[model samples]
Target: MKINGEVTTGLGKAAYFLSQEFYSLEFERNLGFVPFPGTLNVVVSDDYLDEINEIKNNCQNLIKPDEGFGAVKYIPAKLCDEINGAIVFPAKTTHEENYLEFIAENKLRDQMNLKDGDIVSLEF
Candidate 1:
């Protein structure tokens, strides 16, 4: 499946959650590597929001909270053709359903040289 969106800024809080050892380990185990300490926020285009919702509905193998932390759902994704990543939906997120976060082994924004308002493509 493929999804397209515009790059956007986040609340700068992903590091607090993603940097936790519990979550990092779980992410590493699930995704085959420890993700960078942050996520890349993508605001779904209106034309593709419904498609993203459908993918979320059918996606399986979500990562659950260890104990105290919030839960998160994930769908495997690749960004910009070369960046291996995943679309992450946090149970306790500040973002709306139209917004999704991408987590990867490397810093996607830096690696891809993206900025807010830039167009991004995701292959899931």
Candidate 2:
């Protein structure tokens, strides 16, 4: 079975972890990363990253427009007893605003009908 951990802070976006069974290839892959147990990491496919990055970049408070999409910094791996595991984080992450102001000066929001309280949801 896969082991998913609690969300860690400062990793940008939601960063759940794989613990105990983390770095176990089979476990991490459940979260969309290609398990590379040898390196205690997973390979995030380009398609996957792009889709995820887009949403993160748009989420006003999650990632600021200035900071752009938060980059993947490092996958933290820890050794327990004799096992090694890692954690992943965004290379750059900044909070833009508490609220997502979709209505830009160019009527972008109006064109898309994305006004306040309008939820632009996504699916993985």
- Misplaced by over 4 Å in model 1 are none
lDDT of 1 by residue, 1-124 (tens): 7778889999999988899898889888988989899999998867777887787877785777877788888988998788887889787887888888999998887887899999988898
TM-score of the candidate numbered 1?
A: 0.91
Clashing pairs in 2: 71-91, 76-86, 76-87, 77-85, 77-86, 78-85
Tell me which residue pairs clash in candidate 1.
Answer: none
Error of 2 at 97 (Å): 20
Which ranges in model 2 have alpha carbons more than 4 Å from their true place?
1-12, 15-68, 94-124
- Residue 79 of model 2 has an lDDT of 25
CA lDDT of every candidate: 0.86, 0.29
In angstroms, give how far residue 10 of model 2 lies from its true place.
Answer: 8.3
Worst 10 residues of 1 by lDDT: 57-66
* Span of 10 residues, lowest total lDDT, candidate 2: 96-105
